[model samples]
Target: MCIKEGLRLHSPVAAISRETTQDFDLGDRIAPEGTMVIMNIWMYHHMEKIWGPDHMEFKPERFSKENIDKMDHFQYVPFSAGPRNCIGQNFATNEEKIVLSKLLRNFTFRLDPDHKS
Candidate 1:
């Protein structure tokens, strides 16, 4: 399964940048070969255009399989993307899932009545 929930809630990177391999027109702008471009992961993640009006809302159901294939790869990349995602992403994911499962099974958490986190 795709890491839809984990990625949407807690991304792994702040931003990413790369140089263009050749001259190209990005609609209204011209990007020359070797020109540098940066992706603001945080901004994009919360953008209305890319993620709808309630972008900041933690609605993992947005990534349901029915909707997953429709989204562009450029959006919502928590662990980086392509060939540069975290080298140990699989291991990390399993570890976190196991820990969370254990916590849920072993504990009864209660909010502090008089204390604020």
Candidate 2:
């Protein structure tokens, strides 16, 4: 849950662009094939309507089993989604967990007041 929250708040890739393979309907209009679609993953992750008013805050509980179902499956895409997603995504996540576990087991971490993000 913590890792998922971290990814939600800070997705590695900010945006992605793809060329349309066919005419896509947008309800009011149609984007013909060959058009370039730019998806802003960062902006999508911070949507108030989907994530609530406190969207920007770091709250890991948002991914708790009880609350997780409230979200759309596609809303969280730190590695992008579908078949074209990063092949190393699973490996990377497992590696993160292992590294994080070792680090937490070995050290204590605290925010530095002098450093402002």
Candidate 3:
């Protein structure tokens, strides 16, 4: 859940561009084949309609098993989505967890008095 929250708040790839493979109807309009589509994952992650007013808050429990199902499947995309999604996503997520766990277990951290939050 922490990892998912981190991704939602700070995705490595802020935006993605792709060419449509076929004519697609977006309801409001139709995009022809070969049309260039740019998706801003950062904006989506922060949208109040999708994530609520507290979207900017760092709340990992939102991804808990009991609450995860309430979210849209595409709402928390950090590695893009679909067939063109990042192949290294799983490995990267695992690596982040391992490194964070080790750091937490081996070190004691304190905020500096001069630091501003």
Best by lDDT: 3
Tens digits of per-residue lDDT, candidate 1, 1-117, equal 335665665577788888899997999989999999998777767788888887777687888888878979867687678986778878878887888889889999997899964
Clashes of each: 0, 0, 0
Best by TM-score: 3
lDDT of 3: 0.91
So what's the TM-score on candidate 3?
A: 0.87
Evaluate model 2: give its lDDT: 0.89
lDDT of each: 0.78, 0.89, 0.91
Badly placed stretches (over 4 Å) of model 2 are: 111-117
Candidate 3, residues 7-57, lDDT tens digits: the string is 999997899999999998999999999999999999989999988899899
Candidate 3 residue 35 Cα shift, in angstroms, is 0.6
Off by over 4 Å in 3: 110-117
Q: List the lowest-lDDT window of 10 residues for candidate 3.
A: 69-78
Model 1: how far residue 74 lies from native, Å: 3.5
Error of 2 at 78 (Å): 0.6
List the candidates' TM-scores in order.
0.77, 0.86, 0.87
Q: Write the per-residue lDDT of candidate 2 for residues 1-117, one digit (tens) a residue.
A: 999888889887788788999999979999999999988988999999888899999999999988878878788998889888878889988998999999999999999999977
